[model samples]
Target: MKLRKWAMGLLAAGLLTAGLSAGSPREAYAESKQIEVSFSPVHFIFGGEELDPPEGQRAFLYKDSTYVPLRFASYALGKAVDWDPDTYTVTVREPKAEEKVSIDAYIEERKAGDRPILPVDASALQPITIDAYFEKVNYVFGKRTVQPPAELPGIIIDGSLYVPLRFVSESAGNKLEWDGETYAITGVSTAEGAKPYDEIVLEAEQAFQELVSGFTSEFYVLKSEYDGADDAGREEVLLQGARKLLEGQETFRSEILETLKAKLKAGNYYEGAVDQLAAQFEDKKQGVINLVTLFTGKDLTPYLEKAEKELEGK
Candidate 1:
């Protein structure tokens, strides 16, 4: 997507239209477009996959606000959902132990490596709040208005607003914690994060560069092994190293997501170039992975899946 057009189009088409605060910067277009209601095409993506709502629960724009069915969201995220009879409340809970994939061994293994291995700062990624009914004030105005984080936008139940905790954040692997005292959802996130835009661009660039370099080095070794292997040994060593590289590639991608989040901070009008660069970086990396798989003609996916599951808890 063209960064500038995508930003403005979404913002202008009801996803944005932010209201100005009492004493904030006033731009003519922003002021005129406030409360502009327009229909938008929306989709909810979790675990790097897009989800579909049950039959009639398609996402739609109304009153300059986006809305989605609560039940549909919970089901898509693997989160448990319930409704209260008297209190008129809908409840959701995140899985206790969601990902079985372990990061410890990877960390320990990296300690002996030359350059310092930078673990993604999970604390930095903010949770995107979902709601049954949204008050435009929270999402609009000078606040990060570019992207509203409306995966399953707010829905209204009997005039009260509620946000479902399903699919917290795929990019950050965010989790929700219930506070017994306040009865609110909160907790530690297991995803990457960035500080400000400038810092994010710098961090993202560094992380991406390192990942590419690592992939290049591993690819060279894999190619070398493939060239030298006899037919009898080709499937053995060649496929094994290829599988390992794919698994490690996932780790690198996750590590870089935080930097991308910061680099793609919503509502920052001066970041079109950064946005374009980030998207291009993703395409290039994916192209390399595709080529690796195509050249090998070996389905190394099963290995990645097995490692992601059985290798955990070891």
Candidate 2:
């Protein structure tokens, strides 16, 4: 594993000779006698980017080699480091994912003209090998650039790129913020405010009046026409009106049954009137559903939920 890492550094150096270096690495040969453990200030660079180091620390230097600090170096490069007492093992972990919207889904939504779901530019996204994300640390997103934190600050763990989550979020145009008190992470809202889920849904008890009213009206109207051909286009018109009335209906849910519900709300005797209206409205719903099924060649019964949802915030 050490040899492989060492080879990677050399490969980076080889790229350097060809003007291909983003802190690809090379190791130096050294002897203990020629080393200097000093308080002398020195600035570090990974690729072309500078690294800030702590004061008065040893650089593990020999005449030909220099050693860098791991914890600070990794942190500077947006990686976290941990030490385990059980096995004396050190581990590095990647940053948390900002959001679950996939690149493919983002592209699809963009193509569909929907609101942008992800925060990335999509055009500037670059795919890097795990080694590159870890080893190079420096990167560019479209026109934006990142400078490497320190000398080749990354590790190869099982051949997966574990770049900072910030990189993905930045590539996708997602904004990130830290909560200092709770140490929590948050992504900026894609929408303005929270969804009014409560109004979007009606509990059983709350829905009783509206549901029974809408359903009962449709019922009796069809019953009246049971002995005759549903010729009066009145039923179709009422059903369509009823459907539209329920769409995003919180502010005006009872609009279709407005007069009926108003009477009920006002404690007026209105049972017969509402049932008669609903019965007449039945023909309207049937005609539309039949034609829609014929044209689409599928059961639009599934669309009841859709129609309801469409009116969710309207």
Q: Number of the top candidate by lDDT?
A: 1
Give Cα distance to truth, residue 55, candidate 2, Å: 39
- C-alpha lDDT of all candidate models, in order: 0.41, 0.36
Model 2: per-residue Cα lDDT over 1-314, one tens digit each = 13466555544443332112135344422111211222222233322233443333223222212233443333333333443222323344343453123322322332322222233243343333222223333343323333323432223232222223333333323344543332223433322342221121122224444554664465455434432545455344334434543442432335544644443334322133345345545554565456445543445455555556656756
lDDT computed for candidate 1:
0.41
Give TM-scores for every candidate, taking all chains together and pairing residue i with residue i: 0.31, 0.20
Q: Which ranges of candidate 1 are over 4 A from the true structure?
A: 1-195, 253-255, 258-286
Clashing pairs in 1: 18-141, 130-163, 131-154, 131-163, 132-155, 132-162, 146-267, 177-186, 192-258
Candidate 2 stretches greater than 4 Å from native: 1-134, 151-154, 167-173, 180-183, 189-314
